[model samples]
Target: MIQLKSLQRVNPRDVEAPKKFYVQAVGAGKTDLDRLAYLISNQSTVRKPDCYAVLEALLHNMMDELREGRIIELGNIGNFQIGVSSDAVDTEEEVTSNLVRKAKISFRPAKALRDLLQTVNYKKVS
Candidate 1:
């Protein structure tokens, strides 16, 4: 089950109103590539080493494709692409690579993933 915790604002603008709380997800653990490869090996015919090697190469290829302006759609997973946050420019001519202040990888989950999220169970962290 996913764990969550109560979160409240430190300072409330409406002094007369009672404090309100929100629920935020609390991670249970972290899973690294090696652990994932082992799990894959246990579930499939592929060996652990082979799984890790293929995954490592796949990551490099994904990066290369994104750098080349390709939006990668992994089947039943998501679409991945590079996005940029740039400074405001007055005209189209003023827009340039130099204006980009940050670059980020964007992911849009597939229908299956979104559906799964809707069904996942969560519990409050005590």
Candidate 2:
């Protein structure tokens, strides 16, 4: 089950304004890749080792493609791409690799994944 937690965060700028109450995810209740392969092996003819190897290869290839400035799309899964944030430059000539403050991998969830999220049952952590 999806687990949630409530937390109070103090506002450093205005202590008199009172702390804000926020709800966050405590756990998604996930299984690791090896465990996932084992579970898949139980339902299919493929052995766990084969399933794990395939998963590892898929990851390696996906990373390689992403590094080559290509968006990786897993059908009915999501699209993954690289994103960057940079410091503001006064002119185009001032823009350079050094200006890049951070790089991030972004994922745009597919419609099917969004639908799955809607169906999950959540309970607050006690």
Best-fitting candidate, scored by TM-score: 2
Please identify model 1 stretches exceeding 4 Å from their true place: 10-19
Task: Let me know the TM-score candidate 1 reaches against the reference structure.
Answer: 0.89
Q: Please report, as a residue range, the 10-residue window in candidate 2 with the lowest summed lDDT.
A: 24-33
lDDT of 2 by residue, 18-77 (tens): 789888888666698899889989999999999999888989999999999899999999
Please report how far candidate 2 places residue 11 from its true position, in Å. 4.1
C-alpha lDDT of residue 36 in model 2: 80
Residue-level lDDT for 15 in candidate 2: 81
Model 2 segments more than 4 A misplaced:
11-16
**TM-score for each candidate, following the candidate numbering:** 0.89, 0.89
Q: Give the alpha carbon lDDT tens digit for every residue of 8-120 in model 1.
A: 75446777777678889998999988998999999999999999998899899999999999999998999999999989999999988999999999999999999998898
